[model samples]
Target: MINAFMQARTGSTRLPNKVLKNLQGLPMFIQQAKRVQRAKLVDNLVIVTSTDESDDIIEQLCNENNLLCFRGSLSNVLSRYFHAELNYPCDAIVRITADCPVIDPELMDYVINSHLKNNNDYTSNCLVATYPDGLDIEVISKNALHNAYKYAEKPSELEHVTPYITSHPDKYRLQNIQSEQDLSAYRWTVDEPKDFELISSIYENLYVKKPNFNYQDILELLSHKPELNLLNPQIARNEGMVKSLKKDKEEGYE
Candidate 1:
C-alpha cells in the first residue's frame, strides 16, 4: 500500500492554529486533504498529528471530514510518521504537510511514479527546490523510513521528518522532480498571516470557477495580477526549519 501522510499540529509558534484556520469557508488542512485525495497513485491518505491537547482539534477535523487520522509524538515528527506507517501499513510513504493548501495531486503522482520507476530510497520535488516551496513532496521506501526512525538523533532531523534521509544522500538513492521553469520564487505555503492572505486570495479568485485548480492555474492568476506576489514575499521560505536548526546549534549542538 502507498500511504500518503500529512503532519499537522495547532502549536505553530509563528501562526498558532494555522492549520485549523478557515479558508474558503473550511479549515485549511481540510482543503489540503481534498487536494491530496485527488492523487490517482496513492492508495491511502492519512492525517498524522501529535498527542498534545492542541492537536486534538486536528484529530476532530479529520473525524468530521471522515478522513483517517493518527495521533503520536508532539515534537518528534519522525516518530509520528513512523507510527502512522505502522497504523496504515504501506510499502512506500508520501510525506506532506498541512500547511500546504495548494498542493497539486498531479505533481504528487508524478513524484510517486518517478520514485518507483527509479527505485529510489527517497525522492522529492524540493531537493533542489525547482517547484515552489509549498508544493514540495517526498516519497521514501518503508525500509529507508525504518532506518531514519532508528538512526536519526539530532532534534532538527527528528522534528523535520525526511531531513535525516536527505542529509545523507550517500546512504540512499535520491531523485528530484524539477519543473520546466524555475518558479521557486513563489510562496504558497500557509505559515504566516501574509501567506494566508495570498492563499485566500488565490482561492477566492479561482476556487469558484475551478474547484480543482492546479499549479498552472495559480501561475496564471499570479501572472494576471502580479501584485498578489507582494502579499507574502517578505517571509522567507522554510522559516520554521531554519529556526529549529539555529536553535539546535545555539544550544551547543554540533
Candidate 2:
C-alpha cells in the first residue's frame, strides 16, 4: 500500500498555527489533505505531527475530521516519519508538508506513478524543482526510510527527512519527475503572513468556482493577475532546511 504522510504542527515560528488558518471554511492543512485524498495512487493519507502539547489541537482536528494521525518527536521530524511508518507500514511513503494548501492531486499521482514504475528508492519533483515550491512531493521506499532513520545524525537530516537519502545517492536509486515547463518561480507555500495572504487570495479566486484547482489553474490565475506574485515576493524556498543546516554547522555536524 502507498501511504501519504503529511507533516504538520502548530509551532511554526514564522506563522504560528498557519495550518489551522482557514480557507473556504476549512483549515489550510485540511484543504490540502482533502486534495491529497483525491490522488488515485495513494491508498492512505495520514497526518504526522509532533507529540508536544502545542500539537494537541492538531490531533483534535484530525479526530474532528476523521483523518488518520500519528504523533511523534517535536524537533526530529525524520524520527517522527520513521515511527509513523513503523506503526502504519506501507510499500512506499509519500512525504508532504502542511504549508501547501493548494497542492495538486493529479501532480501527486504523476510522481507516485513514476516512483512505482521506475522502482526508484526515492522519487520527487523537487529534486530539481521544476514545479512550484508548495507543490513539492517526495516518495521514499520503506528500506530507504529505515536507513535514514538508523544513520542520519546531522540536525538538518533529522529535522528535514530524506536529506540523508538524497545526500548518499550511491546507496539508493533516485528519480526526479520534472514538469514540461519550469514553473519553479511561483510560490504557493504558506510560511509567513504575506504567504498566507497570497494563498488566501488564490483560494478566494479559485476555490469557489472549482474546488479542485490544480497548478495549471493557479498558473492561469497568475497569468491574468501578475501582481499576485508580488504578495510574497522573493521569499527563499526551503528556508527551514537552511536554518537546520545552519544549526548543523554550529554543532559541528557539517
Each candidate's number of clashing pairs is: 0, 0
Query: Best candidate per TM-score, number?
Result: 2
Local accuracy of candidate 1 as per-residue lDDT tens digits, 22-113: 99989999999999999999998999999999788888878999999999999899999998898899999999999999999999999999
Provide the lDDT at 79 for model 2: 98
What lDDT would each prediction earn against the true structure?
0.92, 0.94
Query: What tens-digit string does per-residue lDDT give for candidate 2 at 187-215?
Result: 99999899999999999999999999888
Model 2's number of clashes is: 0
Task: After the best TM-score superposition of candidate 2, give how far the Cα of residue 10 lies from its true spot, in angstroms.
Answer: 0.3
Off by over 4 Å in 2: none
TM-score of each: 0.97, 0.99
